[model samples]
Target: MSSPRFAVAQLDEITPTPCPCGQARRAFKEPWNTLATVHLTDIHADSKAHYHQKMTEIYIVLEGEGHLEADGQIIPLKPMTTVMIRPGCVHRAVGKLKIINVPMPPFDPADEFEV
Candidate 1:
C-alpha cells in the first residue's frame, strides 16, 4: 500500500448548493481519514448557532468577512482565518462569507446535527 499527497482543493471546483438550513456547501474531501472540506457561501450566523452531535467543525475563511456567534460570543472572521467548533456546540455562519469547513469526524448525512 502507498500514501497519497494532499493538495489544496480549489474553491472554484465546488458548486455551492443550499444546505438543510438554506445555505450553500461545496463539498470536497478524499474518502479517508485525511481531510474533509465543505465550502460555505453566503452564510448567516444562525447556521452555526445550532447544535450538532458527534461532529467537530473548523471553519476556515476562504473569502470575504463575517461575524461568528459561538459560545455566546461574537467573533469576526476574515479571509485566511479559522474558527474551531467542538462537537455539540451551537453555532452558525453569517453574512456573505465563503468558509472552508473541516470536520474531524467527517460528515455523515444521516448524522447531521439539527436543532
Candidate 2:
C-alpha cells in the first residue's frame, strides 16, 4: 500500500515574505487549497494593508496591542484577540503587533491587490 499523501509533523513549515515588515507562512502546497499559520511581526498598519485576490484571511494577536481597520471600521485588538478578513476586504493592523495570520488558497504576492 502507498503511504498517505500527507505526513505527520511536530511543527508546520514556515516561509518568509518579502516585505518591509516580517511575514512568514506555514502551509503546504497542492491538493490542499487552504493556507495557515502566517506570522506578522513588528510592522506598521500601513505596511500590511495590501489585499489578496484569491484568498481570505484571519489575524489573531499573539503579542502586543493594536487596532484593525476593516471595511471602514476600527477595531481595537489586544493579546488573544482575533479578526476575520474577507477576500478583497481592505484591512490593516496598527501599532507594533505580532499576529498569527491564516489565509485560504494560500498567499501569492502576484495575487495581492494594493490600495
Name the top TM-score candidate: 2
Q: For every model shown, what is its TM-score relative to the native structure?
A: 0.69, 0.71
lDDT of 1 by residue, 1-115 (tens): 5556655556665666766434555555556544555655556534644656777778878877777877678889899888888877777666677776777666665656556
lDDT of 2 by residue, 82-105 (tens): 888887787777777777777766
What's the residue-level lDDT of 91 in candidate 2? 70
Each model's lDDT comes to 0.66, 0.65
In candidate 2, stretches whose alpha carbon ends up further than 4 angstroms from where it belongs are: 1-15, 25-37, 40-45
Query: Residue 34: error of model 2 in Å?
Result: 5.1
Candidate 1 ranges with C-alpha deviation above 4 Å: 1-10, 20-35, 38-48
